[model samples]
Target chain A: MKNIVIGRYIPGNSFLYSLDPRTKILALLILMIGVFVIDHIMHMVYAIAIIFLVLLLGKISIKRIYLGLRPLLFLLIFTFTFQIIFNRHGELLFEETLYYSPVSIALAAAIGIFWFFTKRFIKFRLLYFLMTLLAIGTVLSLTLFPGTFATGRFAVYEEGLFMALFIMLRLIIIVTLSTMLTMTTKPTDLNLGLEQILAPLKILRINAEEIAMIISISLRYIPTLLDEANKIMLAQASRGVDFEEGKMKEKVVQIVSLLVPMFIISFKRSDDLANAMEARSFAPGRPRTRLHVLTWKRLDSCVLALSFLLLVTAILSRVLL
Target chain B: MAIKFERVSFQYTSMDNKGYLALADINLSINKTGEFITLIGETGSGKSTLAQHMNALLQPTEGRVHIFGITVDDKTKKQRKIKLNPIRKQVGLVFQFPEYQLFEETVEKDIMFGPKNFGVSTEEAAKRAEKMIEVVGLDASYLKRSPFNLSGGEKKRVSIAGILAMEPEILILDEPTSGLDPIGRNALLDVFYNIHTELDKTVIIITHDMNTVYEYAKRVMVMREGVLVYDGDPVALFSKSNIDRWNLDVPDILGLTRDLEAKFDYKFTEPPRSRKALFKALEGMLK
Candidate 1:
């Protein structure tokens, strides 16, 4: 819950924070398109640099985004492995001939068992996770040798490696860009910005402002709800639900125990909030005044122009080059 | 001692906060039986942190906390062999608005959940559930009903019953009576009072209510800015001349006793512990 950095607005004043949320959101959308167009490694290197620059502009530490990425570790590793195994391209990076006899398989099985027990004692989870993946990769490469377990070809291709790195980089860019937008923009300002972005819906009788308010309020409460979940988790921990010591079935039961309380409490909370808002005479589908209105300044326009330029160059490189 | 803190301190680490010192160095001891202690402090005073340390929910950052017989320190954390859940079963902690934790389908199942998790047989847990519901002042009929269908006060009782069903030797409640109406609060307090008297468990309650302090707390421990500044009899706490320094309101009974002493030109070596004690003192003055 603490590592959920997206939509977690840290209070700071800087170039990114000062940019209009509308501009930031639009720029991120454009940059995402740019990311999809750019297939070259050099272009990705540039993109990574630009991302760090944006991080600097936003006054967000690299550590914050790094922590945010931890939850995606499994997905990243899975995708990397999937791409490397399936996508055969330009040149072979490695070709190996190996055998998996009954004895060798038993040896690997022993190592697997060793890993299963030793994994708990290791505190550095990321390194351990990667080591486990390496073990899995080794297992996948092992094949039934013809006639008394002879050696077989195990291989990797150059473009397969490139593509795997590219896709993972793409994922990180997408996640980081969105995180940047959320980290800088205040929820209320994000709401107003969303209203402006969705203003075209007014022609179809849709209330963009109301929809935006709902979106931002829910986003604002994500962290609050997470904290509530943590508290409830601790309370249940006290009741002898050993989350760390549970079997998979018991873990599911414990998690269900957590979610039920979260659902009930969050519903009660929103009910109280709705009543309080009504008591304060808040009316939906009515003319509303803003405490602080969103503004698009000259700098915001410049930022948007730069994003548009980036998008054009990316498309040109993808199509023409 | 059931629990002992030796120069214990705690720092909270999160995404943004590298570490915030929530509890500073503190030393304290709690007995295993028949001790009713109230932990009182202003908000963010580390009272709750101290309470958490009892069951190893939050271990010390700087020093060791001895719980039952197990010691928690840097070494224990490193080894990670000794399970903390056994300690949890011994020291039950009920957080504020514990009603929010009521999740089981029926009230009986909810109460049984704790004991069953601690490895009690289902039948035995059910029997404990039957006993605990009544201990929290609920009728046995509540056992069959869905806990979600209960009223706020009833839900609160059900949650506390859930904790009690485990039959913890030490019970810690964090502002257990906060949201209840006065009548409901007193009734719930009486439930705990009876538990203290009958079961003889070491009960620690963290509260902002000074009146409960005056009434039920045999001893009061005051926390300020992550430090335990006072630990003694509640009567001695109220009698302190600079009581305002702790930002505590003089409990109503104490205020009335003070006024009675001023108006009647009476002084006793020992201050009255309760309204009934004040009444007896007043009778003695008249004589």
Candidate 2:
């Protein structure tokens, strides 16, 4: 149970792993901004291509990326359905009592485009060009197609298509950039980067050390909590607690039983951890030496520079073109 | 004065909402001065449950536990009202796999935790910690190193030192040598012996290993299904025939010695606790 979640971080000397955490974080921020600035299929295509190229260089497996996407499948489907039903601005391809709108079609297209780009980012093993092309196709399909089903209901397919493309491009860029950041950075380094970034809050008498401790504890416990949840589920299953056989309310009651035990165990572990920490003289305000130091190299600088250039170009294309 | 339990009964709550009686009515006492007392029982026999009661970590559902004539509940309430700092200062407990209790990044800080928590000054805590580190036979160089990084035996020793730093009068250890290899177990036994002989601290150990009880304990307590069935000298306890009825085995050395005495038709005046003692007894008989 403990080993299951911990095995996510593959140990390797890939370029992605070697890049500074701060650089990755900054690049992620820039990409998210660039995603919002994109207004056309061409720009969306370029953004997807860049993300794919980064994933290829990172050496992360496509299977692992797909696995990451498994958790978000429901959300993706919901977004697609919501967008398709609500879009009213597009031309009606079929007539029915319930007329589909151009707006709904554009929204569905946007969702599809975002999903495709996000999936590519998750499938980090795909060839750079292939992932980029898939991302472009997603954006184009979303932007050019309106979800209207009614015929002769004042159609404006070109406007709906362009709008859908624009929205899809934005979403694709955001998801790809965020996924890339997470896939490339270690949690520990990310924590250190957070500490460095939040250091300015020290002026308000807020202790950075305490905040860092909280972050570190949260990071450490998430995997632990998941492991505990898994065990509790297994224990309940062994005791004839069929979670799948129950109605919603019954399932909730069963879940409550599992959660109660999990919470109890977590609290006990926390108390033990506290005692252990105290015994080790881990008091607030004490200066401690770090074993692993974060260093920024030339590669980090180059990545940061390229990310900024992309952001500037994205903005220029939106404003000037 | 030392730890004593008077007619104590405890009931454990099971997952199915049923009560499992852990310890039946029992009376036991230990002196303040150094003495090794071993409690032996099978799994679910209340050996561990009984040990927890010694330090007031768990209160008896019935009867009373007295530490140096002060009832544990009385002390617990008083400590809660004012603080438990004093009671905790006197009775230190080293739990099973005590190394897991280590939370400090450095060994020195971990050792100082108990002392500091009890309101000892930083300087005094450090001094006590240094003494404890030596007492546990760990090098001073370990002071700066992380506790988690230490070997299993070393981690156990560090945990023991953490308890000792508080200067507890009575030390309760639950399965101290459990999960250790033979050599590690023997080395730990030596450490316990040193604590008993040199420090004069009252020590209570919970174990099921008959040989350990026979060899080391001045007094042996046998518990069966949470009932204190026998409390007497180790030699006399081993000689009893009804032991098998209680699902208990005599120590291997004692069994061999008893068989020899039966075959030879001459009584060995003293029952041997170890191979050396058995050899010495044989030499005397031959002479």
Candidate 3:
């Protein structure tokens, strides 16, 4: 089922996993912003180097990282084709009459960079330096390079293709980095980090702890919900309910029937969870002590400083440059 | 006054070209009152399918099912279908893992659902819920708590409470004690016994537990591969050598008593129901 991918975090321990979730989150955010800061090919080369260094430091296997890219192939191909067909200002590579322009080359280069950095982030073994290098390389390749294929009637332009590449790279980097943060960090750490990050809302009388509790519960239920859904699906199948063998509309109806039991079970589980929480004296406003306190280490401080610097650089490049 | 199936045959549709026959030419009748019937069968013995027919959950593919003089058939009139609801209301079915039927958030709500669905007033339903809560030997405080939060035994009790609130005349439980710990199973059996003795409701239990059948049931129905092989007194059914043929086991105490009777040339005036009963019978024979 598609839901199998939703919360499928493989349990492991490595340098990346040991880093505080807050540090990883902040670092990834910085790397994503920094990817857009580079405009030249040399800067992109540096970015690629940084990304690979990060991957090396993380100690993640290449095969594991490649698995994350499997689902994104179609999206990459689609973006590449769209850029090649539409961009119309670069030198024609294929035929002068067919508008086979330089933008196609740039688009493909951008996709390669996007795929590399994003795949590295999700795999969690890549070092920050390696990730940074990959990110910059991807951004520069899209921005400065000419299309590989162009024609006389419609030349594939470099600028528009770069823009498309930049947008896609940014999205992929952000999502993959976030997914990496989740994969490496324990759920408890993630919740605590969210609480700390959202602490500013306390000034407005918002309960950060309560919000954190909700977030933790939501994360905890993801795997549980998946398991319950699988069980219900199996149960329905045993009753001669063929979900896989059906037309599109019939499949939808079969899925609905499958979902009914899942929803019913979830509601019951939620009720149980609510009661269990209440029984444990867990009130919304009550202050609770943490077993694992969050403290900033030297590495965390470095990551924090780097994040702010990257953010500032990105904004400056956008406005001043 | 109760359900009677005459020469019923049922074939279950199978994926293979050669289909499976679930029930074959079975005839049985459930009495109106004071009947503790146990259906004993192996996994694919069509016992569950037969039980479903009692509540009109499944109509016999062949032959007639008459419940209180109303014949249950494929061509039964539409207006008569409405009558089946009342009959179904009377025949409360507790399926395997009956606890899964508990859908409401609160225990009270879960218990009241059946009564509410059957058009009972809120006040009456609440009253019934309280009575059932006591009947199931659960605390009143559990009523406000979630059914899912309770222990396994408590969840089973809540499920029973749900069905009991409907005030069914015939309560049918399918493997009510399966998967329960020994203590939990004993407590559940006590609940079933109380339902039979205190409420005077006709009880039909579907179980493979020969101990349960030997201890509580007045009548036993043995099914083997979709055939009703034995339908008679619990003692008579246990005494039959054909039990081995049906791949059924007699209760341990009953088997022991029978062995002693054959070997020592002695017989108890009445068959023992439990280990304690067997000891007492032995003491009586010695005296």
Give per-residue CA lDDT, model 2, range A220-275, as digits (tens): 99867885675555333322245445568667756664666576567779999999
Candidate 3 chain A weakest ten by summed lDDT: A234-243
TM-score of chain A of each: 0.84, 0.71, 0.71
Top candidate, metric TM-score? 1
Better of 1 and 3 by lDDT: 1
- How do these models rank on TM-score, best leading? 1, 3, 2
- Point out where model 3 deviates above 4 Å: A2-8, A36-45, A96-155, A160-168, A247-253, A310-321, B1-95, B98-210, B213-287
Question: Per-prediction DockQ, in order?
Answer: 0.69, 0.02, 0.04
Q: Candidate 3 docking category?
A: incorrect
The alpha-carbon root-mean-square deviation between model 2 and the true structure, to one decimal in Å, is 19.5
| TM-score for all models, in order of appearance | 0.86, 0.47, 0.51
Scored by lDDT, the top model is 1
Off by over 4 Å in 2: A1-321, B14-16, B73-83, B262-265
| Residue A47 accuracy (lDDT) in model 3 | 56
* TM-score winner, 1 or 3: 1
